[model samples]
Target: MVNDKLLQNLSRNLLKILDDDEYYDITIEVGNDPYVNIFRAHKVILYYRSPYLRRILSTNKKKDDKALIHHIKLPNILPEIFQIILSGTLL
Candidate 1:
């Protein structure tokens, strides 16, 4: 149906934003030590998509004054697992 196609297109577009480096307002660092991976994302998208992240963001609402970018570090999750988690959140 038309609606399904529209949704598919929307999802594709949303995924494109994940790789956009110019406009992202937040940096998420996943994992610890030598295995860490950093990802950039929009705060508004993260705010609405996941309740767990919402709670985390709520506590860390203050962005760095110089760059205006918020930073979050997750030492628990592996980078590979976090990528999968983030993709699910965007969908």
Candidate 2:
């Protein structure tokens, strides 16, 4: 089960990223099923299961564009992921 503290942190980070212009249209999903949490942006679809054990997956995108695929295993790592995504390093 996911920790409550972790979930709070993740939600905070996601909100911060949502304020950015570049990611304004980006979609954020959190769930158990990998298929359900997957998000599609333009021609790319970013998917993952969780933070630590999760494997980031993407399709129909170039290597450079794949940087947007940001998959966090836990809510605690949301801050880091948020920074990366905002910097355009991870999606």
Instruction: Write down the lDDT of every candidate, Cα atoms only.
Output: 0.82, 0.43
Per-residue lDDT of candidate 2, residues 28-73 (tens digit):
4533444233332321212322242224433332466646544333
Best candidate, lDDT: 1
In model 2, how many backbone clashes occur?
A: 6
Model 1 per-residue lDDT tens digits across residues 4-91? 8899999899889877899899999988999888988888877777887889988876555576787899899788877766676431
Q: Count of backbone clashes for each model?
A: 0, 6
Which regions of candidate 2 fall more than 4 Å away from where they truly are? 22-91
- Give the Cα error of residue 21 in candidate 2, in Å: 3.9
TM-score of 1: 0.73
Question: What would the TM-score be for candidate 2 when compared with the true structure?
Answer: 0.26
